[model samples]
Target chain A: MTGITLAVPSKGRLEELTREWFAANGLVITRPGGARSYLGAIEGLPEVTVRFFPASEIARELIRGNVDFGVTGRDLIHETSETGPQSVAIARPLGFGNADVVVAVPDAWIDVTRMHDLADVASDFRSRHGRWLRIATKYITITRQHFARFGIAEYRIVESLGATEAAPASGVADIIVDITTTGSTLTANALRVLEDGVLLQSEACLIVSRTAKFSARRRAQLDSVLSRLGAEVSL
Target chain B: MTNAAFRRTNLEALVEAQGATRATPPLLLPADPYFDLAGEEFGRRLLLTTATTGAEYCLRPDFTLPIVTDYIANGVGQPAAFSYLGPIFRQREDGPAEFDQAGIELLAQPDGDVALDQVFTFARAALDMFGVSPNIRLGGVGLFEALLAQADMPAPWRSRIRHRFGHPEALERLLKRLAVSHDTKPQKQPSRADLVTDITEQMVAAGLSLAEGRTPEEIADRYLEKQALNDAHVPAETLALLHEYLAISGPVLQSLTRIEALAASRRLMLGAPIRAIRRHLNGLGEARVTFDASFSPRLDYYTGIVFEMTGRTGDVLASGGQYDRLLERLGAQAPIAASGCSVWIDRLEAEFRQ
Candidate 1:
């Protein structure tokens, strides 16, 4: 019988977390080639095969239908794929790698408490400063959609590389939209989140790409593997 | 492709007959320099950019900039008309963004009225060449700005709303905001309720700190400013009047009447732009076109009369408008009166095939 390919991150905290979660779910993964092996098998469920790849690629592979199921963060899926029903389905949220994609501004703008207030501030800032208010973030799509929804048009997006939270302090941008977990980076830079600026609460999820057609054996293997993980509850 | 070629020839002839010399600009240009001035809206839509000399250079975003820059660089101080047929690039949210455009540019075009009339005539003929009955709309954002100039609103509010004329939803929001009067009058006793959560409480929380940008008193003032919006409400009559003005959409002449009446009642000065548009339409003398009173062009550089022609399916077949301020901003010796129109070659081709 052809095996159902299960993809997970090859290294990092995500790899450790995935192993522990699988072990807790009563599935022991074994590989003859040991730690460095990219291919492995799940014990007690022989038809369930595991493939180790970079954490970011897991989502892309799942969406490509190359694998039956995979683990990746919600942010990556939102960033990389056109997600929808019948394409790639989020079978369950694995619940680790929590981060909030947020819009933030200087704490000094104590007057800008809400999205509408920020819009007003943007206009005021423009006339005063002689340029559109700039927001630095790698999440261009999310930032554009969210900003447009609030009718904030007098702003520009500067595609930032790293340390987006420090953009405002470094004089590159007037504001920022970034993914933050602890809120420590933003605070250290004296930035504050608007009252309603949270764009997304993202975490890892198990996704099944609908692009792949499964035979009866592969389908059964997937069902058995999911049930063992107790993630079947989501289905 | 044949139809596009024919339409291009037809448009070029019409523009040439009006004393334009055919000119072609080079495809590539410095992109990073334009980024700061084009603002975010147009800057984002620029399609091609490549790194050069520690900055990104770009393809030509619009015809006006390149044509004008060419003239200025050539030291052509005299009146001139130039026509061009070429591909322009814009980044679209969907589909291919590169498009072939045929249009003209008039330098030192004598006066505002003549320049507008010239462009209007060109738009009419171009639409005719495509064999589509022109569905025309004329939006006077200049008139709108003049109206705002008479309003008691703050400069920040006025400037924001004035620039948003092309964006209907945002313009509506601005109108709603205008209908309410912000409560900016100082109070004898500022309430402590706006600051019940102690500042120190935030400091103890990890990854949280007060910004040195504003003092506690200044923060309190901000809270007061927002609270002012709570009680700020404009008179019902004024709001209804503004709504009625925004709602007026139909034939150009009728819309003008409604606008004149609104101006008379409210004492808003729309005299200059209204007179100019009336003169231009009367000059055209019943061309096969219908006017939309509510339409504004998307290009923010359009400082005055914005016109667009649509097909039966509501597709924009051709559009152009005035950008006198654009010339001034681009370093013209004085604010120059300029207007131009562009015909979409593909849409014209589609019309011919059908």
Candidate 2:
């Protein structure tokens, strides 16, 4: 029988929310060995197999069609690549995780308030220093596309694997594009997000892979799960 | 990493072997030039430099423009075939910077159709090697442009229609309106001639010459206290009629007939490129091509066909088009008619891994 594979975050508060959400839908999720064991299942939705993975891996797997559907963050999906027709966002505001991907500069630069200011600074930096302005961020694609819309031609991007907020003071970058739910981390780093610099306000979402094979049995199983979940949640 | 390395080496060898058969050396290009040619948004990531004389350059965003530049600079007037392989950059919302892209360019070909076919063949083969069986969907911008010409709309209105033809929402809206009969009077149906006359008179009174970059439409809008006039704000009744005509723009063969009928009705003639493109599309058998009258690429550089190949999962794995005007902007004396595609290697790799 064809079954729909559903991936969920394996651990952390996200995992707890996954179980709670499933339980609220009258489907119980359980992993016997807790931390070490990655396997989990939703009670009464036996046809739907739940594979536990990190949030990022879940997003990737959904895109690859390795899993029929998955729950992950909108930021993760956008961070992974351009969202195309192959992936459909089934449900958003899943109410567990939320964050904003933003562009931030040094707090000392009070005059810089919007993306246009950043564009101006980028151009001035390039002309005066004879080099492109450097921006550190993990969200390189979104950053590039955003800056392009403003007609800012000359700017460099340094990929930051971690601690992006520290890049400006650390001399690793001139500015940063990163995620922040609160301004505390940015303030601690002496960096402040610019006004109108929030590129994306992301939250958790239910996503389905358009490329995934959906047999009659699997589709029915998905419909059943969605119906149960829909009944449980109030619009 | 090892698997990727192996794939890269294997592809490089195969391309090199093909290059030798054509008596051309495989052109190895640095990633930076591709990024430079791609300009602002298209370029991937730029690495900052410390050397005083060194400029920050990015990983190449695309291959065609750089390859074309190489062809023009090194082998000007000579036939050259060049292939390249390297990691390109694009931001992944959740991932890293580098993505592999490899392709070839054939310059100075007598027949562009033959070259286009080869490019398609190469794309199919490349995807096949990675076990991706893609369904090819085709469309042409020229055919859409031809249909707009027949709409008998003013230039600004025609431009607006042409600009938005490829957009599904805009096209569908236009088509739906065009298909219906308009019995109601428009909220506003100012005469274009009168508007033009009023604008000219206003400009003359203001001591502004007509030649001062002021279009008749602009002057008309100023007198009417309206924003810039395009076909978009035309009376709903008139637009409905125009829409009815546009709704019939279909597949290449059917679209040709529709365009012909439209031209006869309007007493207008189709341009040469439109004719050439129709002939080309007619020859492409069962390519799943649609003639979208309103397909505009986000990148303004695209002068002709713009397409994006999406995976079954809905990810845009590859997107490219003809950019005949880009070369001129980059300082070429004559317009270079060229087309190229870039595969989102990271997305491809992700699909393969899955």
Candidate 3:
């Protein structure tokens, strides 16, 4: 049988956390080709193959069914797929790497403290400025869906590569939907999260791709691995 | 299956007879105006593409936006009438993305009554060309606003409620949240006394002298105002009246009478809007028109008097509404009184096929 493939974040704190979580669960990952190698194998599981990728790429691979499982942020999984839980299912949340996707505006906008209030302000901004209210965000799909839910239709999205918190001050965008853990960065930029504007509370999760084909033997292997990791996932 | 020959002869001739100049709007238009005017829900249905220059364009989903923009650009001062016949493009759930549409736009009409009469006359005339006077459904945001304005609440609450009136589910949830008494959620926030002490400490640490800045009394008053805003709730009577108002749906004339009685009972002053709507319905004569208060259309630009004509098979053949602020939002210097109706030629063809 072809070995089962699992994807994990290749870099940064996420990678370190992934290794530590797996080790704590009794599965140690080893890189035979060196730490720089993208391929690895789980100790004592000859059938389980591990591949390192960026968190975003891990999400994509899982969605495309190129990988059987992945450990990535819930936000990235949502961003990668239009229909949540149709292509992949969350096995379990890892509980760390917690961040909230939120809507924020300059604190000086004292009149705007709620999503509904933002709607009114957006319309007013359009008429006065003769353009759609610009919202800078790296999470375009999430922002669009969340704004649509609130019936906010009068804003344009400006894709942010980095430093999204500086968008409002630099006149790049009027507001932002960004990821924040401590909120110190947002507050440093003089922005405040709207009272009812937390769109998603995301954490790293172990996800199983529903589109992946699993043989009887592969399914048994996955079940054992999940049990040892205390994931309690249903394939 | 429709009489294409009749559409070419009768509908065009009827539109011309109404003194509307036939014109053609460009097939592709800047996509931002549509998203800005209609909202993202409608915008997502559009067929959009970006050019190398990074300018986004979409196939014209409907003629109204382009026609009004053209009027504002070329014919703002004079009352103008125009007619368009062509294929509009959009992603449809039930049919081809491209389909034929024909409609008339009346812009800068001086009198609202005359504008309504003219638009309704064209709607009737177009249907008469098919020799079928279908049932018409009417709704208006003005009536909803009039009823909402009578509720005694803070301006922000009133405004937020009005903004959400078009969306029934959101309005319902919002009303329920506002109705819950503040005393029930004792643990949800810090006590007011604790908050005052905390704020005083923070102000002192930040080097703001209490006397130089806001005094303790002013701060306390502001805190109370903030609490009032936070705890704002619609009175039970007002909530019931609003639900009753939204539920007033039946024959246009009967619904008007029902609204009249309801307003009288509630002591809400909706007299002017009720009278205006009653006058328009009466003006429609014996046409089979029904009214539904919660009938805002997909297009958010409709400020008043939205309507649709349904065929015998329950297929919508035409729909339109009045939009006084459309031009101003589209970049005009001031609001222009506008109203028009659109005939769904493709739907008419399907109706005939059936």
Off by over 4 Å in 1: A1-7, A18-69, A81-92, A124-127, A208-235, B1-8, B11-18, B52-54, B72-78, B93-97, B152-156, B175-234, B283-294
Q: Tell me the tens digit of each residue's lDDT in model 3 across B24-117.
A: 8888899978877776667767889999999989998999888887777775779888888888998764433888788888888788778887
Q: Model 1 over residues A109-128: C-alpha lDDT tens digits?
A: 65676777777766555445
Q: For model 1, how does the per-residue alpha-carbon lDDT over B37-81 read when each residue is reduced to its tens digit?
A: 565555667765556456666677667678877776676557778
Q: How well is candidate 1 docked (DockQ)?
A: 0.27
Q: What is the interface RMSD of each candidate, in Å?
A: 5.5, 16.9, 9.0
Q: Could you say which candidate leads in TM-score?
A: 1
Residue A80, model 2, lDDT = 67
Ranking of all predicted structures according to DockQ, beginning with the best and ending with the worst: 1, 3, 2
Model 2 misplaced stretches (Cα beyond 4 Å): A84-86, A231-235, B1-27, B36-40, B44-354
lDDT (tens digit, per residue) of candidate 3 on A97-176 = 99999999765454567887677667456545656678899988788788878866667888898999988766778789
lDDT of 2 by residue, A42-139 (tens): 77667777889999898788777788777888878776666532364554357767889998876544345666555445544533554556788988
Error (Å) of candidate 3 at residue B267 is: 4.6
Residue-level lDDT tens digits of model 2 in B183-259 = 45434647768767765664454333454233456434432432233123455644654565555545655765675
lDDT of 1 at A109: 60
Best prediction by DockQ: 1
Location of the lowest summed lDDT over 10 successive residues in candidate 3 chain B: B206-215
